[model samples]
Target: MDLFTLTVVNAFIALVATGVLAMQGQADRQFRYQRYFLLAGGCMLLNAGISAIHFSGILLPYWLIPALTNSLSVGASLALAAGIHRHLQKPGKRFGLLLVFILLFVLHLTEFARSDINHRFLISIPVVLLLNLWCISMLWQHRKTELGKVYLAFIATFAFNILQFVFRTTFMVLEQHQIIQTSIAPVVHNVGFFALTAFAILVFCCIILLSHSQQRQMLQQLSERDALTGLLNRRTLELRLNAEFSRCQRNNSTLCLLLLDADYFKQINDKLGHATGDLAVQHIAKIADQQLRDYDLLFRYGGEEFLLCLPDTDLPAALQIAERLRLAINSAPLFTPQPYFLTVSIGVASSKDSQSWQTLLQQADQALYLAKHQGRNQVQSYQPTAAVSR
Candidate 1:
C-alpha cells in the first residue's frame, strides 16, 4: 500500500479509537447495552490497523485471511447481537439470534476455503443481507425514540458497507479467474474496499458518541438516587415534588405528604453508636419502601425524619400507609440487645391543589406535633380548620 493509503486508514482508525475511549470514560452505568458501542468500536479500530498492514502484501498465508476475518467477525457479530437484544429488552431471545449468525458465518467461511471467494459470495451475499436486515429491523422498532434514531443511523451506514463488501469480494475473486473484464476490476475492488473500511469506522464512531450522550443522562439519574435507602435523596425529592405540586394546583388534584421520625433514634445512636443508627434508619427505609406504590416518592428528608409524597392519595390513604409503616417499625426489633424495640411516629397531611410545598411541609410538621402530643408512637393527621393547641 502507498503511504497515502496507509496514512488515511490509520488516521480514520485513530479517530474511531478516540471516540470509543471518550465514550468509555463517560459511561456511567455498571453495564448497559449502549456501552457495547464503545467496546466494539475499540475492537474495530484495532482490527482495521491489522487489515491495513495485511493489505500491504507482506506475504501472509491464505489461511490467515479466512482465519483472522472469521475470528474478528465472530466476535463483532456476537457483541452486536447481544447488545442489540439487551437494548431492545429482548434478552431472552439472544441465544436464538446468535445461533443464526454462527451458522451463516461458519458456512460462509467453510465454502470460501474450498470453493474460492466467488462461489462463497453466491451463498453469503443474500444471506448477509438478510442477517443485517434482521438486526437493523429490530432496532427500527425503536425508531420512534431518540436513541433508536442513533442506532438506525448506525444500521444505515453499516448496511451500505456490507453491501460494498459483497460486491468487492465477488469481483476480486472473479478477476483472479478471468471471469470478468480485465481493465476495471482491480480499481473498483480496491476503491470499494477502502471506502467500506472507512465507512465502517465512521459508523462505529457515531455509535460511540450516541452512547456517551445516553450515559451522561444515566449519571444524572444516579446522582439523584440515595445510596442507603434506594429512594430519591432530599434534593431530588424537593425538585420533583415542587414540579408535581405545580401540576396539582392547575388540575385541582389532591397531593399528600407524610412526615415520619423514628422514636428514640438517639438511643440507638448512644447505645450502638453511629453505624447502628445508620443501619436502623436504612432498615426502616427498606421496610417503608415496600408499603408504598412505585409512583410514590420516598426521601430521607433529613437526619431521622423521612418524607413521602403520594400524588392523588387523599388524607385517609396517606394516614393508612403512615400507620402501617409505624406499626411495621414497632413490630421489628433492630437487633437491640434482645429486649429493646424500635418504633416511629408518623404525621400525614393532604390538601386539594396546594401550590406551596413549604406550607405543605409546615402542615405535616404540625401533624407530627400532634402525634408527639398524643404519645410518642402513633400516627396523626393535620387539620387546618381546627384551632392550634398551645
Candidate 2:
C-alpha cells in the first residue's frame, strides 16, 4: 500500500495495542511490567499519529510540528527500552530518560527543526538504533527464563531494527555526499518504509505475547499456591507427593511425610477474627518452613493444616524433625492484636517397602488424629498395626 495508508494502519495498530495493554495492566495489577508496556504502546500510537499528520499537506506551527513528531519517535523507542528494563525488575534510571529527551530537544532546536524534512530521519536513526540495541541487550541478559526462545526472538527483531536504521543512516550519508548518483535512494526509502511498518507490528506483537506468557505463569502460580500462606495448595500437594514417592521408590531411598494441623484453629477464628486466624495460620506455616530442610516440600493440605515431605529420612529421624517443628511453632509468639502463642500437631509417616502415596497419607492423617486426641501441640509417629500387601 501507499505511505499514507500504511501510516494510518500503523496508527490504528498502535492505538489497539495501547488499549489492549492498558486493559491487561488493569487486570493484572501486580505485574507492574504491564504498565510499562502500556506506556510504550501509547508512545507508539502517538508517534504514528504524528507521522501521519506530518505526511499530510497541511503546514504545522514551527516549534510544534516536526520537532514533537520526531520526539515522539524517540519516546516510543525509549519507552520500549524502559518497559523491558522494568520487566526484568532492574533498578530504575529515571535521569537517563530525562537526559535523552533533553538531547532530542536540543537536536530538534538546532539541527532537526532548521534542516530539511529529509534530514530528520538522519537525526532519528542513531537514537532509535541505540534504544533498540539497549532493549536487545536487556532481552539477551534475561534469555534463560522459561520463555527463553521468545526472548531471543524479541532480541533478534530488535537487532534487525538496529540494522535497518544503521543501513538507512549509511545510505543517507552516501546520498548526501553524492557517493553514487542514481535513483537508488528512493528504492531504499520505500524498503525502509515497509520495514518500519512491519517492525512496529512485530514489536507490539512481541509485547502482547510476552504479557500473555507472564499472565499464564502468574495464573499457574495462583492455582498451585495458598493465597494466604503462599504455600503449595492441596491441588498441587497430591501431584508433588506422588512424584516424590515415585522418586523415592526408584532410588530405594527413605522419605517421610508430616501432616501438621494448627491446634485449636477454629477456636482462634471464633474468638479472634478470621483475619487474626489467618495471621495464626501464617505464623504456623512460617515456623514450620523455618524448621524444615530447604529441599523439603511444604504444602497447605487444607485450612489450618500443612503437609511436609522430607526425603532421605528414616522413621526415627523423621519423628525427631517433626518434634522439632512442633516445638518451634508452639514456642513462637504470634504478636497479633491479641498476642498469643501458636501450636501445631504434626503426624509423621516414613516410607516403607512397597508403600503407596495413598497409604502414607492415610497413615499420617490417622497419626494426626491420635496426636490431637491424646493432646494438642505434639508430634505422633505412624506405627502400622499389620504388614499387608502393597
Candidate 3:
C-alpha cells in the first residue's frame, strides 16, 4: 500500500504492543508468553515506519527501505519463536533457537553486504516458516492441556505473519520486475497487502487489550495488598472499613478493629538478627491469617503492628478473638533455628456510637499502648466511651 497507509497501520500496531505489555502484569507464566508475541509483531510493523513517512520534507532511498524492513521482520520472527518455546515449557531450547536466529541474521546481513537481496529474502522467510512450524508442533504436542489455548493463539498469530509475508513478497517481486502499472498490482497485491495489515493489526489489538486489562488488575491488587504478609495495607483497610461501617450502620451490625503488636521485637532483632526477626513476624502473620475469616481485612500498620478489621462482630466477640490470637502467639514456639520464645499484645476497640474508621483505630491504639504499659503478652479491650480520641 501507499506510505501514508503503511505508517498509520504501523503506528496502530505500536500502540497495540504497548497495551499487550501492560496487560501481562498479572498473568501466570504461561499466559504471559503472549507478551513476546505482541512484542515481535510490533517490531515487524516498525520496519514499515521507515518508508511510510508522512512528511514530504524527508527523503529516503529505495534500497535502504527494503533492507531495513526485512531486518525488523526477521527480528520479530525470532522473538516470537523464542516466546513459543517458553509457552511450550521448553525453555531450554530457547537459547539454542535464539543463537540460530542470530546466525541467520548474520548470514542475511552478509548477503546484504554482497548485494544479494534474493538470498537475503530466501534466508529470512525459511527461518520464519521454521519458527511457525515449531510453534505449531509445540501446540500439537500439548493439545490436551490448558496451554492449548495459548497454542491456538500462536496458530492465529503464525497465520497472520505467513499471510503478511506472502503479500509483501508478491509486491516486492512484481515491483522489482517493473510491473507497477499492471492491473495485478492493485487487485492482487496493493489492496490485498493493505487488507492483510489491517487484519494483522486487529489481531495485535486483541492481544494488547488482553494485556492492558491484566496490568490494571495487578495494580489494583498491589494497591490493596501488603507484599510480605499478603494482607491489606493501611490504605486498603481504611477503604474497606469505611464501606463496612456504612453497611453496619444501615443494618445495625456491630464491627471492631483488633490491633496486635509483637512483644520484644527489638530484642529479637538485637539477638537473632533481622533475618530471624523477619521470619518470626512472617510466622505470626501466617498463624494470624489461618485464624481469620476471609471477609476480615488484616493490615500491617507499621513495624511489628497489625490491625484486623472485623465486620459483623461485637466488642465481646472481638475481645474473644483478640484473646485467642494472643494465646496462640504466646503458646507457639519461635519458628526459627534460634532458641527463643515470642509473644504479642492485642488491643480491641469497638464503636460506642457513630465513629469514623480513624476513631476506631485511635481507640485500638490506646488499648494496645495500655497493654504494652501493663506487661507484654495480654489482650486489652476498649470499653465504649472509656477514653477520648488520641
Candidate 4:
C-alpha cells in the first residue's frame, strides 16, 4: 500500500520470525544453525524498526538512519549465509564476516554515500547480491545430498531477492539521472519493500519445512537402526532381506547370510559392567563393518548378535568373508574401563541352498550354533547334511 504501512508490516514479520527462531533454538539446542538464524532475524527486526522510526517523521540526524539500516540489512544477509554454512557442517569465517560488516558501516558514513541515496544503494546492494550468490553456490555444491531438494525453496527465495535488489537499483539510478519521473521512484521503492516482506515470509516457511524434513529423517533412522550399535535393526532387516530374496530369485543371482554372535559377551558384562559389554558389541560391529564390502548390509539381529546380507555372493565367497570377519573381531581389542579381547562366531548360508530368506536365516543360525558348540571364535558353513567349520 504505502511506505509507512509496508515498513510496519516488515517490522511485524521480522518480529514474528525472531520469536519463532528463538523458540526453535530453545527446542533443539543441538541445532547450532538455529542460533545464527535467530541472529539474522534479530538483525532484520532492528533494520525494520529503524525504517519504521524514520518513516514516522521523527526528528533524527539524516545520515544516521540510512547508515544504520543499510548496515543492519547487510548484517542480516551475512548472518543467513553463515547459518547455511553451519547447517552444512562447514566452519564459518567469523572474523571475516565481522570485518565485512565493519567495512560496510564505515562506507555508509562516507560523504559520497550520504550525498546521494543512489550512491548508497550502489555501495550496499552489490554486497548483498554477492552474499546471496555465495549462499546459492554453497547450496548448489550440496544439491545432490539427501536434503538437496529441500534447499530449492531457500535458493529460489534468495534468487528472487537478488532480482528485486537489481530492479530497485536500476530504478533508483534512473530516478537519480532524471531518466524516470520522481513520482515513479517511490512506487518502485514501495514495490521493493513489498518484495522483501514476501522474501522474509518465504524464507521462514522454507526454514520450517527444512527443519520438519530433517527431524522426520532423524526419527526414521532411529526407528530403523539399533540405538546401541547404530546398525540396522532386525525390523529393517526383514524388509531388506525379502527385497534381496526377490531380486536374487528374478536374476538367478546368489544371496548369502552370515549370522555372527559375540563370544562370551555375558562374561564381559558380568566381570566389568553392562556399559563395558556395550563397548564390546560396538567394537565387534566396527571390526566386522571394516571387513565387509560397501554394498553388504549389516543388521543387529539380537543382543550381541549381528546379521550380514551379502548380495550376489556364492557359498565359497561368503565363507571367506565370514572367516575374514571372524579373524578381524578376534584380533581387535576392546578398550574400556577394563580392556578385553573380543571374538565372534560367524555362520554362512547361501540362497542357493535354501528356498527362502527365512530358511536361509535358519540355516545360518544352526551353523552359528554348531560353531559355538564346537568352540567359539570360528566360522562354519551350512551343508544339508551338517555344518562344516572353516
Highest TM-score among the candidates is held by which one? 4
Judged by whole-model lDDT over C-alpha atoms, candidate 3 comes out at 0.71
Give Cα distance to truth, residue 108, candidate 1, Å: 5.3
Pairs with steric clashes in candidate 4: none
For residues 1-390, write the lDDT of model 3, one tens digit per residue.
554665667667665655555455345454757766766766655765664662233676544455556666666767766666655567465566557646764565564534756567687777777776776677678766544554566566667767677777767676778877565555565565565466556546545554454456678889888877777787777678889888887888888988999998999899789988788878788889878998887888887889888999998898988888888877778856755677899988886543777788878888887787777699988755555333
lDDT of 4 at 314: 94
- List candidate 4 stretches off by more than 4 Å: 181-183, 247-254, 292-294, 312-317, 336-338, 352-355, 385-390
RMSD to true structure for each model, in Å: 5.2, 4.2, 10.6, 2.8
TM-score of 3: 0.51
Q: What residue runs in model 1 are displaced by over 4 Å at the alpha carbon?
A: 1-50, 83-113, 116-195, 336-341, 387-390
Q: Estimate each model's TM-score.
A: 0.73, 0.79, 0.51, 0.89
Q: What lDDT does each candidate get?
A: 0.70, 0.81, 0.71, 0.87
The residue-by-residue lDDT of candidate 2 on 1-390, one tens digit each, is 556667788899888888888887888788776766677778778877867776775566655567776777788787778778888888877458757876886788775456775567667667888888888877888899887777987898898788887888778777887897658776787788778778887887887788788878888999999999999999997788899999999999988989999888898899888989888888888888888888899999888888999987888999998988887776778887656988788888888833798888988887888788878788988767732233
Top candidate by lDDT:
4
Better of 2 and 4 by lDDT: 4
The TM-score measured for candidate 1 stands at 0.73
Mind giving the per-residue lDDT tens digits that candidate 4 earns over 282-369? 8887887888899899998998999999999999999989987887776777877555778788888899989999999999998898
What is the C-alpha lDDT profile of model 1 across 193-251, one tens digit per residue? 57756665665665566666577766776799777776788878768989878877778
Ranking by TM-score: 4, 2, 1, 3
